[model samples]
Target chain A: MGMARAIEMAKEFGIGMVSIKHSNHFGMSAWLVQQAIDEGMMSLVFTNSSPALPVWGGRSKLMGVSPIACGAPAGDERPFILDMAPSIAARGKIDKAIRQGEKIPTDWALDSEGNMTDNPASALEGVMLPMGGPKGSALSIMMDVFSGVLSGSAYAGHVTNPYDPSKAADVGHFLVAIKPDLFMSLEDFKARMDYLYQRVVSCDKMGGVDRIYYPGEIEQIMRDERMKTGIPFTRGEIDALNEEAKLVGADTLNV
Target chain B: MGMARAIEMAKEFGIGMVSIKHSNHFGMSAWLVQQAIDEGMMSLVFTNSSPALPVWGGRSKLMGVSPIACGAPAGDERPFILDMAPSIAARGKIDKAIRQGEKIPTDWALDSEGNMTDNPASALEGVMLPMGGPKGSALSIMMDVFSGVLSGSAYAGHVTNPYDPSKAADVGHFLVAIKPDLFMSLEDFKARMDYLYQRVVSCDKMGGVDRIYYPGEIEQIMRDERMKTGIPFTRGEIDALNEEAKLVGADTLNV
Candidate 1:
């Protein structure tokens, strides 16, 4: 929708603004935020799903592997984008680990009884642990409330599995877009951001730590490097994509 | 400031909204959100601070103990409030532990070199671990960006210690308030929220877990209980307060 139209509709309803909730999985949150940025606004998006992990201290699968993304436009470069799941490793990453026959990280998951485990299968059976512990669990809970509860959608363990076709997976999403010139000049905001970035990066590092990275820095670098080298897909992922292409009766595997 | 005025000022600057980076360690985020609620809006706040502990994998002080709070006004009952820190325990709790001459929980903090320690002093020297591990670290980073980077405030280790006045701590905060009625009817929104809450809470628990608690459930209970039975203060806390009172030439312990 046109940003102006959306904002106008929001005003008409007596709502301060409209935040779309329970949106379909939109791939990368950065992509959607970029759309808002294109309309000259800053954006934030959060999504929640089935209980893939345990809350801090608790061993049962109780919370979703929620994810959050944010973006702001910059004049000379790509809009700043920050997108990540609230887990040490996202489910997709875990699937990849399983396919690669790699041992999952110990902290990433717990067995059914809540003991830490490194086996991919065990991690899958067990809940993915919260990020920091209680903090991550709390974040996951908040995401569930904002994106799911407030939206009147499924939450936590009750949410349908996004990966399962038989289920509707009543996923929920929360989005907010702010015009840059709301409180301060966009130019000034950008300048201040630059200053903050510089100061943070220039700070002294802890032992063995070479540098500090802002949230979106590594992602940007990864996008650039991957774009140049072509996207790398594991064999299983390639097969899965090819199978989907076949189902759609489309050409597959140009490479 | 009135919500309308704040929104109007923000709109003038091309900002679709305004989010305050509040200081004074606002005791309850819900209180701030209530302001928005009084104006018929939704609001969110995010804050970050020093490392209370390490991420999940290795034992080392790395990230800040952070918190994110949000509220959405309802029709009759109090607005839904969600406030939480990323750490298993706040630094203040450790101080309380010291005063009580009690050993801190094993999971709460680590020593200077990252070994788990129940000693409050060691935990103070060492960093407080993230709630989940990487997930906690990730949330801390997100809060740092939203509250610090975006809001043009200090973040992570760079934030000033709130306890120590001599240091120039630019502790960062982010606040956002929106009028939900702008998009849908208030009644409809509330009904939806009620449905979502009921469904999620009704879901079966794993093992012996008794009941599912919503985000603000515990806090609401605590607030009510504390209000009826005055908040308790430890002797050490009372002594400290008395010392400060003396500096200001005021009597103490009337309560």
Candidate 2:
């Protein structure tokens, strides 16, 4: 992915943004931004993928559940991080509900007939709706423009799916990295960030609630827990990854 | 406000951002971003306001229905714009619904006791819910960080309502502008944008749908139509505008 190179360029040249045109799916945008923040850089990233959500108020799927991610460092434990897709619910989440034989909320998706549905199976066959309706749809379009159109990458329906054997994915990404020291002292900036995090989390809580978290707080906790527990993988996953590595003549991941 | 100045700075340089603190409530952010794009610059704006929404699963009203706005020129007709608050429903809309004696949606707000309610009066007395649970709550926090915290402005519960006569609204705003020419050719960028827009709106429509609009399309239509037929105002609105104008030693408009 271009994120690593973009981080390097920003550190060297103060501010650098890269628009990656032709690439495979880049795993979680949070991971990429946190990578930059670890090196004392503030980062914003946008990426477009295959269409999943329909345009707000429209029936046809026209936009990706594109992600918007941003992060910066703090003086304390967790960094300020935000990573979210435009959709109200991701298809992966719907799939999980279906696998567990659960009904979904009515807001999650529109059935194939373009009417709201609560059935998980119908939702899976239908289109996922964007968060906040038109607003999220617009955000998805902007992400696509920044990552795909601006970068001379695939745009709209032209973008392919990597999971489909006949398609090439053709994902596009846009990254903006800023050196924290360029605007203010890195130490001071970090201190200010920590102050903000503290203020937000220390606020009065609701009854029956014992914990408050900033955007990145829970994700950081889960990532840590998973690290301690070790990542789980199916046998098929390991074999598939190893086979791809073999084709590329590279050392394979243990998976 | 800072949006205009940020746009100027971004055009002079390549990229420029401004964070303003201790400010009055800036009007709808859509207007600000549209202003920038009209001058051929891409813009993003974040503004924090009085607390109106609670943290995702929390009972306390500790966060504002902060708005996020962004826009970029698309060919020659209109800019692609997105402007939204983090709440599932805006107070203004809820107020209108209450005035019309309509029942609100259950998911839109919590009752005073933190139970979901469809009663408009109870919803108004309580707090609005976030658009997509945790995602909207996180976005709201990010807006506060960018506008209020980074700018050394009032944040969270400290941000007061301008409408409350006894309190001063120490609102804050963050603006970012980028010169289109700095990234790529303006014409080419616009062309690509037109291409993307065309692809999206032209996609096959779902049943009973005749059109698909990109973000800002409806706004653009209304603006043009209102331009042909002058903007309408209620008698009270006209009197209020005149009174505010008189306080600033400005001429009164003939309505």
Provide i-RMS per model in Å: 5.7, 2.6
- Give the true-contact fraction for every prediction, in order: 0.11, 0.41
| CAPRI-style class, candidate 1 | incorrect
What tens-digit string does per-residue lDDT give for candidate 1 at B97-210? 999999986667767765678899888987676655444555666566566655555654566666878765666666665545444577866665565445445544544557
DockQ (0 to 1) for model 1: 0.22
Clashes of 2: 0
The CAPRI category of model 2 is: acceptable
State TM-scores per candidate: 0.73, 0.86
TM-score of 2: 0.86
Give me the candidate number with maximum TM-score.
2
> Which stretches of model 2 miss by more than 4 angstroms?
A1-15, A96-103, A165-167, A181-184, A203-210, A233-255, B1-5, B8-13, B95-103, B164-168, B182-184, B238-255
**By DockQ, who's the top model here?**
2
